[model samples]
Target: MPQANGHANGHANGHVNGHVDGNAAPLPADLIDPRQVKLHDALHRLRKLEAAKDIDIPQLIVVGNQNSGKSSVLEALVGFEFPVDNGACTRFPTHYSLRRGEASTTAFIKPGPGRNEVEKACLEELSRSIRNPTSFHDLMRAVNAGLGKKVGMERTGDTGKGFCDDVLMIERRGPDLPQLSLVDLPGLFTASSGHQTDEDQETVQEMAETYVRNKGSMVMVIASAQEDIHCSSGIGLIQKLVRKDASLNERTIYVITKPDMAQSFASLKSVVDQFRFPRPAHFLRNQDSGRDRPRSLASRDAEEEKFFGSGEWVGVPQAQKGIAALRTALKEMLWGHTKNQLRRLIPAVQDMTEEAQRGYKRLEEAGRPDRRKFLVDVAQDFDRLIGNAVIGNYVNREFFSSFDDTSLEVRYKRLRSTARALNKRFATAVQEHGKTVVIGRPRPSGRPHGSAPPPAFLAAEIDRLYSYPEPESKCWADYETWVAGMVDDWRTGEPRGQASSMAYWALFEYQSRGWKRMAENHLKAVWMVIDRFIDLALAEVCPDDGVAEALRRRVMDTHVDKLRLAASTTLESLLSCHGRGNSGFYDSLDDPHTSRSRAQALISKIAELPSLDGGGSPRNAPAL
Candidate 1:
């Protein structure tokens, strides 16, 4: 079984590639593979550095049906004792970590609960169990004695409290690059046993789905005696575990425990063969070959003797052989590949960003107008009213003692009145300056002298000129750029309008080439700017009593209700236009770009509104 003359330098005990004491020489600098350059290279370098420091700990999770020796497996691996019983022993996720020299290892055990009240109770049970485990003999006695109590907590059944129903996370210190840690998932269907009432099957199913969805470690399923490992229940659970949305399949390992039962051990191979296990290899010899491999003092000899029959071992030789085979296979599988470890746990959000970029390009080609037109329009209006809008009679007066003393309510009311006045003045000016000019006459063919232009054809032309484009490439680019800019603002705390330029273009394209464009743009732009301004203003508003109290007092003393009514009405009208035919530039914000643009527009308007001081100044205005 030891492979005859297997020496320390032989493949069995040697360091990975056999470079003196396991350290290999560095690769040549010019060995750069272009495919491996840039981001991929950076990723590779990071993985290597992490691997060099030996921090890529494998998480081992133990899972099984009720009383399937799940806890025993953990105890045997760590050479310690975990509470065991005849029925469901562990109830929640428990983490175990240990240190050996400079290396470390971690393991996690995840379980389900029968009731909401039992969750916290079970978590405390797991914590206490790990901190104070019974002796090996006592644990063995408890297991053979049948379901006695909880594995980790002191309270039993209805009395347990404060248990968290989550997977256990364990970390053990060993070599810098320790073996993959283990995880023990709870029995698939037996989480609700000791409770007084029937459990919510839906709740358990949801919990199971949540665990599978968020699993950060390589998964392993436990196979035991009495339970048909190949039954629909088992296959269905395994199928659920393997299903994935990304480019790669979730890796799973199957372990057949309690092989001491001949019925299970005899047919385990046939059952395991059903599931496809990729990257198979073999190294260690089978124990049934009339010999036994010598294990280090780290292995539990007494326990192995008791578990395996007096004349025969308990675990399948194929299973044990499969483990070594699995290790070698994993090493070969992991060679040069940076994925599959825990670090990939953080999803690759960059992919979503790339998809958005492609969408944006298509939107640009759809013949939408740009946002600069809207900005220039607004700027022109400002140019016309600059003298009156900025240098109003009350502009020079002090409205508030300080930024903190100013009332947002008072500020909003004054700004609304001022904005209405300016808008009236601007409209009157435009009306007075209005002059229609005929550019050219139509190329008319023979027709009745008083016949009007064909109404149907005229309507068709109007529709063609004003209709918004269907959702497609035409809207995607602006959306992507908008979303990206919003993300940047979130990260940098910069004023949101920094990204409004893209949104402005998106809206302009929607409005100018369509009908009632100017009116729609105004409504949408004002709403967007108002939303953004409020967000910024609220951010500046101090949460403490001083500023909040001052503002509360001012609102009570002043007619601030009118200001709120105006802002609310303006916003409501803008929102109403969203997704309607007249919406044009102010279309539905379901798309990321639209949402971002809307946010920016709101911020811009809010910034333009008057400050909280009694003088009715702009909050963003330069100091006198």
Candidate 2:
């Protein structure tokens, strides 16, 4: 075979004649035909690589109507006959690889997946039977057996008794054969017979479409010159596929068979002129007698020469007619296409190999136990969630944004701010609404105008305050009891005690109720933060339904409950201290009108009073 020979031009180095440009250098006499040999070998390697990777390799697909000279064209190209019959002779796809060598043929059947050992053994025996076949009939019998067909089964659709999609591969090598590889799919048909159902017809069409529709394939649509071009044949089907992918017209080749029998060339000429079918259409006479009658190689050649020399085809381009012309056209087309595909194929195969390696490495790592790494990952995720909850740096917007107009994370971040605002409101409610008497204001005309003793006035004001329940108080009984004690203390106070004790208890009780409500609200806000944190963490760390549920049950549920309880306890304790009277009550007395400077000296003694909870003296109370 012609070698690359350090030349940049592929056709220039090849021994193939007429394929190269006319001005290219001539070839040596000893060189093998590169068009036939080099191209075939390159394509063979590509097919092998594609099969190994389970990728789609480029192909030349043959499609035609039943008994439309499809088998004749293929047999003529391959320089041999395998099997052909009247109606739908080929049920499954048959791939032919032709080359120049000794006259020999080998066959192999690639049964599709799920075949048992028995079926494999049967296929192997069938292959052996085809190798030493005495006649084409023997080949047909082996093909039927390999496809799992019974001897008497009718050739129906793919749903027939022994229908399969597995390819029947045959490699034929002989002298003067053009190097070519082609797949002959099942012929297209319109109506179904008693044996072939509508399902069968569809199956056959589907199998044909599978090959012709491949973008990487060069589709050869065969139509008998005697038949209507617009009929529901393989040509029409090819046209449909070409329409869907306009680029296919550049790769598609139309082959007109049985041209000698065509009654009128006017319709065919119009089709070619209008570009109805993709050209160049090669017209050939493959069969002179019936389909079953075999023609000798010399006789076939003589007939082709006679047809071309006749007056009917005088003006037709020599390159656009005859089987020999078609063979040359195919070789040239395959060479150019194969070169382009190979250029692209190398990088694609490399990328696929690298990707597969990465996937394998990942799978290998997954097979090993790495609990330490897993735990570290979980810890990292937990820390991230805590950070997000505290600082509102959430990643998934859907987790919060989709739940409501405002996200849960945003609300969680606002918890502290919301609590502070409520606390301020609580203080304002205490300052404006909690006071029963204005220190500098006089009594109204209809009310008791005369001032009683300071102790008696304080007791009457406490009664009025406790009679109407404060809107914020949760514990009314405790408040009433505390008020009664304050009144009693004021009544029993020493003479100078009036200023220090004046209405302080009523103000203290009112402020305590406001603080209690604020504390409860703050506790609820903290609970909401924890709840949203659990939701955010689960969504991030355990998005799977099962994993999230397990985490919620095993970890989040108990953990959040404990957090809620602890926060509730802290807030409740703070509120409870406010609810009971504090020693700081005397510190709130700032009135300078009374003669209680000496009583202020006694205020320090009352400031050290123990709390009602029996805990140590209360810490300095929060500012009202």
Top-TM-score candidate index? 2
- How many clashes (backbone N, Cα, C below 3 Å) per candidate? 76, 0
The sequence of per-residue lDDT tens digits that candidate 2 reaches over residues 141-246 is: 5687556542213353444443456677877655555566788887788888765668768878888887777766788888876666667387678677766888
Would you list the clashing residue pairs of candidate 2?
A: none
User: Residue 96 in candidate 1 has what lDDT?
Assistant: 45
The TM-scores of all predictions, comma-separated, are 0.34, 0.48
Candidate 1 local Cα displacement, residue 138, angstroms: 14
Worst 10 residues of 2 by lDDT: 3-12
Off by over 4 Å in 1: 1-62, 77-88, 97-163, 166-182, 190-205, 231-235, 241-250, 264-266, 274-624
Residue-level lDDT tens digits of model 1 in 15-77: 211121222112111122334334333443333342233233234344445444455444333
Q: On a 0 to 100 scale, what is the lDDT of residue 572 in model 2?
A: 76
For candidate 2, the C-alpha RMSD (Å) to the true structure equals: 31.5
